[model samples]
Target: MCLFTETRIKFRLFEGCAAESGTDGEVVLGVEAGTYQVFALPDHGSAYGAQWVGLTGGTGSQDLARNVVVAAGEQKDIHKIFMDRKGTVTGVVTGADGAPVTGGTVAAVTPVIGDAGRGRVAIDTQGRYTIDFLGPYAWPLSFQTSTHAFQWSGAAHRRQSATLVPVTAGQTTTFDQQLALGTLVKVTATGSPSGRYAVAYNNSNGDVAGFIWVQQAGGQAIFRVMGGQQVKLQFAGGEPGQGWYGGTDFDSAKTVSIPATGEKVVVYPYS
Candidate 1:
């Protein structure tokens, strides 16, 4: 409960002189994701080299630097250690020559996340792009637009936002997209037969229930029971979790594989 024990953590970004030079800029530091205490002296050729890292593991004390301590009541910016250990700022990527480039590479220089989490996405025909992942590692990404390339290190963060970068999920981000591009697939019931059916969709995991249509869009629609095994297409009309037919509480859900790129199957149900 003593204010004297209050620890101040500071972080510094190693950016580039992209203003003058046109090379791939670099940002380097030693602070981990959390916080730390520090003393900044003039550069000594090497970074805060060999400094004692007393990080305790949690987001609070994981990357605490040793040998230096900020006085109580006085907070110092020790950001010199934890760089892009945050999120990301991405939209469209262009070339130095001001022309659109395709397949231009984007590498996370400071992995706010981890190596496996290093994000890389292809620039579309329109030069629009999105970061795959950005975590706690302040790894500034290196972008190449034709002969022109730059790094976000030296460049001041564009938006004066919460000062904290947040991660964007869903690796399947759309490129060159303005609106939500919904995909459409066609389904044919054929002589499918009448029944109670449940439809499932694919996601990062395996298969999950998306929408459970009773019949085809227009056939006899009714709430149907769903099971864990395969999606059931019970022929008998019944409420969800009830017997669609006889001994069969709900007819057996046909255990089958749903194609990834084609249309989902739709079964018809009788009244």
Candidate 2:
């Protein structure tokens, strides 16, 4: 991700009134005793980021305005915040034997901030892929392919140990990874409304390995997963607070063993 600094600041304060920063990038606004959303436009002006403020405090996030509260006759001071910039990543995928991996999708996965930094790109026949509009952050990137195999730059197998890659604003970073031969499992689901269904897997310690999302065709959906390891499946979509193997909620989602044979696993939702 990138960072952009602008001299002028514009804000949509507390419901209706709008304010602009002076030459020194400062603004004073009189607001009522209620929460308000603060939105600003960057240099590009295509995207807007927002933060929320209130008489008591404020909260913020990427590409979103935060909430703020104000009390009666109270004064508040706001600080200058940095805006997120964009970056691009280009790469290629290959198999364990250095052969091109075809017909699979590649994703730049980051363990930080939960899946917020994850971006995906399709692998072309020649195994080339690109993930763009990424935020500038140095973190561990795990390259996950369609078969749930992880790889690192200049490695031949799944990346158990990886290093942090730095991405700068408005710059392109090249990262190529090789996939290892892993067990395969054919997963299908049943007894749910027709829509896109996902089967997510996590390790024993509850860390996400990968997830397979497929549109359900005729009450059945077919997807593939790397097998020979213990994985837990959390069914997303169709219904809520139900369909877990041994529990009643999505948080307590079920766990199953994908045998070394890489056999098929069918989920019977609400069954």
Candidate 3:
């Protein structure tokens, strides 16, 4: 199993600037002149974990990263980052019919500074999966299979509603998932510009059910939502700019009610 671990490091330069260091152990990044916090994250499944420039033990927190001031056209060398060994999570994936799911993926998401630390692994033929090299923290797990809708660890659809699994270094945690059927929602956007648009379905709790990109104006995109769930549709990056369906903003947007599986909902033009 150790051979399957990925040995790459991701260097984050504060905000959104990032660079990847491969097996050669070298990385170069160009950024604007400013004060930035530098941190490195080892790829998921690696025995090593994430850490700041000067911090060891793989705390995986950006607050611990050292602050460095860089002037325009000035080159600075960040010290080597040291990481500690991480934990592992293993489980079995089963379908709604109580049978083991043959093929799929399980992902663990950890909330961190700037961006979340994520690790994903494929389920084997026996429906077993092991996510290695996760920092010691409470993580939300997401399961996806070709025949079932994506679901969180507690069989919840939203991240906020899912269960948080605890992980500890030098130990293994067990987490299992059972999937449920999802409702299919088809949205049609008309009277918009002839460009790609992203349609997102957000629930009342501000949790996104799913999103898809429409290739052209008047085109349609489909995504899955929970059955009998009420959600609001938000459109972005198209002719009329970003806005919610039935209204210009989130507060005024009309709520869409999803029917059962095999049913479809068509969203008309944005007013």
**Cα miss at 10, model 2 (Å)?**
31
lDDT of 2 by residue, 172-240 (tens): 888777765554544454554455444545443343444455555424444444454556554455456
* Model 3 lDDT-worst window of ten: 1-10
TM-score of each: 0.24, 0.50, 0.59
Could you give me the TM-score of model 3 versus the true structure?
Answer: 0.59
Q: For residues 44-114, write the lDDT of model 1, one tens digit per residue.
A: 22222111223431121213434344455554433233312223346555443445656554533221111
Q: Relative to the true structure, how large is the alpha-carbon lDDT of every model?
A: 0.31, 0.47, 0.61
Show the lowest summed lDDT stretch of 10 residues, model 2: 4-13
Candidate 1 vs candidate 2, lDDT winner: 2
Candidate 2 ranges with C-alpha deviation above 4 Å: 1-80, 83-88, 103-118, 142-163, 168-172, 186-198, 203-222, 226-230, 257-269
Clashes of 3: 0
Query: Can you tell me which runs of candidate 1 are displaced by over 4 Å?
Result: 1-89, 110-118, 136-139, 153-271
Q: How accurate is candidate 1 locally (lDDT)?
A: 0.31
